[model samples]
Target: MDEVVNAIADPVRREILALLRERPRTVSDIASRFTISRPAISRHLRVLRESGLVHDELVGRQRLYTLDTAPLTGLAEWITFLRSPAGWQHRLDALETEVRRTSRERSTTPDSTAPKENTA
Candidate 1:
């Protein structure tokens, strides 16, 4: 999970993933799309592969890279949990209960009013 997060942190790596989503490409093919050196692109691909976001296969002398997408399932699930209605409802209910308790306490307590000054 940490590896996935770290790999996706870079814009270049994200672009590489986007390209893989369309179709698999060799290291040379991916490198040609950007201004960076092939070595740099290779490094990015290495991170993506290590993170389980991508997989590669050797076709003859060339290695083609493709998106794996399985590691992303956990990230999707976490986002879904945060966006759930029940999660928000629980928080709102707790806030409402606290507000009601405070109001009740205020109403039950005797007022601490200052004495009024007598008029001349």
Candidate 2:
């Protein structure tokens, strides 16, 4: 999971993953989307391949890279755990309290900034 996390930490690598998600692409196809050099894109692809986030298959003279999301299962679970209802419930309760407090203060505070009524 750490490798998967680290692999996707780079914005370029994430974009590569998005491209793979849409469809398999060759190194040239992936490299075309970024301003970075082909070697840099190759390095990113290496990291992704090592992390099992992508799979490459040689089709005749070209290699096509495809996304393999199985490795992200653990990361997904960790995220779901982090965003559990228990944690969000407390946060929502606190937000509700703060909102009510702010509303009460606004209602009670002086309306000095209020626009004066037009006297025809």
lDDT of each: 0.93, 0.96
Q: 64, model 2: CA deviation in Å? A: 0.6
Best by lDDT: 2
Task: Please list the residue runs of candidate 1 whose C-alpha ends up more than 4 Å from where it truly belongs after superposition.
Answer: 86-120
Q: List the residue pairs that clash in candidate 1.
A: none
lDDT tens digits, residues 18-88, model 2? 99999999999999999999999999999999999999999999999999999999999999988876867
The runs of at least 3 residues in candidate 2 whose Cα sits more than 4 Å from the true structure, single-residue gaps closed, are 85-120
Error of 1 at 103 (Å): 28
| Each model's total of backbone clashes | 0, 0
Global CA lDDT computed for model 2: 0.96
lDDT of 1 by residue, 46-80 (tens): 99999999999999999999999999888888888
Lowest summed lDDT across 10 adjacent residues in model 1 is found at 79-88
